[model samples]
Target: MQRVAIVGPGGAGKSTFAQALGERTDLPVVHLDRFFWRPGWVETPRDEWRQRQSELFAGDRWIADGNYGGTFDDRFALADTVIIVARPRLACVVSAVGRSARFHGKAVQAAGCPERFQMVFYRWIWNYDRDSRPRLDIALARHDHLDVVELSTRMSMTHFLESISVR
Candidate 1:
């Protein structure tokens, strides 16, 4: 679908899925992390972040990935399709840890922001279902017009990706 938004916890493979989907659909892929984080992991100011997001959303076609809850509504409002990667917490944590190891000191998703493991990040991943899922649920409810796809497991995610046909 055009104007897709891929969202989930930190380690839910949002970037990977967005890349694959973009490849298949031939849509421009936008990684929110790249825009939200400046050098040295500094966050863009909230107002500036919103402005950047608005500019990104001005495009007619794109596959944007990341769970920047602050700007989620804006992105969701523009997206025709929303993909949620709802993997298990343990799986997410493990995936995050693995990503940190593999991409240590190198920018992976967020440009100029090298991957690093932190206890707080781990805790957030651990508590994502309890803390973030409810908020996401509310957002999804508010956006009933959007086509939402939830992949609750690795098998489901694989199947969903495999089922997509390039236009």
Candidate 2:
């Protein structure tokens, strides 16, 4: 795929998958977290965030990984393929917790944005299927022409990766 959009809830391995996919396809990887957060967990202004997303999506080839609902439409419109990493809530929670522990007080995905565990984030992960999936579904519906790959398990993700015939 030329323009790939990797999306899912926090700790769903979107960044990891996007990195792997980018390596396999020789495409540049764009971590939206890097652009969305300013510093110290501060958020970028909505207008500026959207503008930045547009510029990122304007690229010819790239693997963007994030779940910024506000700019989903713009990214999806430009993406030729969408990869949804849909792991179980328990797995996501565990992954997120472990990541936070490993990267606490240090930036991981975004510069100047130290990782930290939050109950609210965990709650969002736990309720992603019920609360967020519906919105994702609607968004996906809007772009039926695009190839959408949903990896519901680790094995499935591996299988999908292995199936890609990268040059």
TM-score of each: 0.95, 0.96
Number of colliding residue pairs in model 1: 0
102 Cα displacement, candidate 1 (Å): 1.3
* Candidate 1 ranges beyond 4 A from true positions: none
User: In order, what lDDT does every prediction score?
Assistant: 0.88, 0.89
**Which regions in candidate 2 have their CA more than 4 angstroms from the true location?**
none
lDDT of 2 by residue, 1-167 (tens): 89999989999999988888887788999999999988887899999998988988888999999998777788899999999999998999999999999988898878888898889999999999999988888998998878998998988998888888895
TM-score of 2: 0.96
Q: Which residue pairs collide in model 1, if any?
A: none
Q: What C-alpha lDDT, on a 0 to 100 scale, does residue 71 get in candidate 2? A: 75
Candidate with top lDDT is: 2
